[model samples]
Target: MGPLRDFRPPRGILVASSITAAAVTYLAALGRLELLTTGNFASSQQVTAGADLQVANLRPAAEQQQQQHQQHQQQAHQQQQPSGIDTGLALSRLEFEKAGAYPQVTSQRAAAGIDDGVVAPQQQQQQQQRLVFEEKLQELASAADREDEVAHSRLLWERRWQQLWPGQAWGSEPKCQEWQASIRPRDFRSTWVEERLRGLPAQSGVEIGACQLRVSMPDNVQMRYVDKSADAEFLKSQCFAKDGAQRPDIVDDATRLALIEDESFDLLVAAHVLEHMQDVLGTLRHWLRVVKKGGLVFLALPDLCDFKYPFGDRLRLVATPAHFVEEFQDQNASRRNFEGHVLEQGVSVAGIDSLRAASGLPALNRTGNLEDLESITRNFVAMNADADRLTTKMTVPLNLAYSTMEHFGSYCEDHPHNVHFHLWTRNSMHGMLSAATELFRPLGLTFVVEELHTAGRTEYNMQELRVALRRTG
Candidate 1:
């Protein structure tokens, strides 16, 4: 039994099995596998019959008949005239062709096309406007398709871009997505980001995102360049864009995900987003592991908490005694309890300032001086004082019974059929950064350097601090 000989199937049985497998594969290829075992073909026959009776059965059948009659009339006219040339057909064909060939309108595209950077009066103004509208529709379509924040952010960018340029057009056309997500690098102020290039001590190379750089000469081009650009248009944009702001290696989460599992980017940019994360520490640890020694991570989060919530139907809103709303504080678990809301998943956003300081990221990486905590808090207060915006004004009127003035945090949780998991404030953000400096001090992953950035509605708060952080081993 230990070394038993294997038995083979009979010739006839083998042939039958092969035939069945082949038939199954063939039917599957034709997308008719269900027809093999079930009366699916018969069901299709019923649908086919209904389609045939489209001219006879439904109310639309009358319209179909009229269309057939019109087609017959058109054929009759074509038959009556011996010429193949049809001016009407030519115009219709041209329009259909134009629909696909025409580039879509985005702010930059529109700006590029317009005279004096404004919509020019043209007979095709209507067509251009339609293109702009389609661009908006396309963005919404993209948003609907994506479940994660990455694509959502793109739509946010699209909305903001559209607002900036009303009749803008997109040079690139986005089609139905193929993957779960793609990587996007945060915008770099200067292409020349200083980095200690791996393998070369004290050597720094300017890094550029895939969007801003192109590689040429196939034999000499790099794999990174290949992933960045494949077509001439992409190559041109990445290569020829103005301002020689030293291109740097810019990679997004999805791209980095392909490179490393359970890892975060060396250069992380949090733009009003860190507050959304339930566990800031867990996320921080993940990024710290993969980032090269001396590489930078950046953070920029909203200081306000009026727009966050939990994740379920039972998620209820709680009232807090304060001017601030108790939106899900990724730092605080229970809306009512400051401690329960502390961590979402395994990450904690507490003590960011101490974490950075403990790790070694001092603002004085350039200035060569350590930032004291008192100075940090004063800076945080100053930043908040300059960056804060009051959004207590509701755009839509709410009944007094439903409205909770100071307890507006419930608004985010109650509306949209779910509650957020965290609420962040300028105090919390600076506090978390400040806190992480102490909390992360024991964890061995500390920030060596930091750059601060704050950005929001230009009308509300123009004070945007973009922080780039270097990790000290």
Candidate 2:
């Protein structure tokens, strides 16, 4: 009965005595169960450091025998045994079975805050906190993946856009920098119109071709409307309409503005007007002449590649600074320019079949009117006869036929038509203006570029290229 000595008993008592010795040794390693004979509980360091280290290393192998031990304990607990059965051995084995559930040793399990099959309160709380942390980490990784996808898609779109429209990469040339009036380019929309007008030290201004009053004028300023063909009846019949029923104050050629005195107005406003003029530079000179010194000339014109809502001239090649200068040189460029516009309109807007029928050619008339369409399509065959001989296409094909330019020139002169005479973009327009200063300098016409703004796509793709100039001389 000593704690450390082996005792031999009778054959029936031998089994109980051996079982008791094994149970006591196992519990002692746990540093929990006390030995009554030893008078003290086993110390943790003593079990780990002593020669009984083999007992501490038996957990994995012991767990495999747990089921057999559990069955034996159940039978022992239910049935009554003889006095020599050693009840302490059965109870100790049951306690060891319950505590051995942890994957590691009993002492290590206690330090880690785990117990039996049920986790300790502290350990359960830590597991829940770990789960929450793992969930948050997964969410952050998912968000990062989504952001990466968006960034990659955006980069692809930008590259595709750059390939499609090369002209979009404008306003960055060394010379263009000289014309840069703003630290950052501003959107020159209708809303921007009023804000600029209010800031001007202007009282008198004339709005040429004020078809649609896109912006409200300042109450302090006196505004006058002047259109080339402002007959209300004529305007109503045209494809475009005016803002309201208000008529123009003066009806005259916007390019000439003959009635308007030199240096008479403080400001001249023209929206969708400058592109129609034949002599781009000369027209600008005339506009400058009409405005007083320190006067503002505000212009809003459409870009040639206005993909949104384009006109008949959308397909035409953008007129370059050199082309504009060439036009400025020709004294009678108006007649040819007008004829070009009529041909472009007849084919693009009025349709090739409509033009053929309007001209009494062997084709069905699709458009209702003949007289108006005829004027545009008249001499279409004669001007493009070479093209007809070259190509047998049924469509009324048109090309830049300089050999027949004289034929259409005479026709357009006698029978006038409304069309866009010039096609330009923001960059080309800036280049044209830059060229104009040098070309017109000898002509005693000098002006300073006050501002340049490019409006983003609005009203379904219609972009505006606006410019403000102050007449210096």
Backbone clashes for every candidate come to 66, 0
Each candidate's TM vs. the true structure? 0.28, 0.47
Query: For model 1, what is the alpha-carbon lDDT of residue 189?
Result: 29
- C-alpha displacement of 74 in model 1, angstroms? 99
Give the per-residue lDDT digits (tens) of candidate 2, residues 74-144.
Answer: 69777754221122222333333444321111232343455445677667554543333333223323423
Off by over 4 Å in 2: 1-189, 199-202, 242-245, 310-312, 336-338, 346-367, 370-417
lDDT tens string, model 1, 350-406?
111112222233321112111232333343333234322322211111011111211
Q: What does the lDDT read for residue 388 in candidate 2?
A: 25
All candidates' lDDT scores?
0.30, 0.46
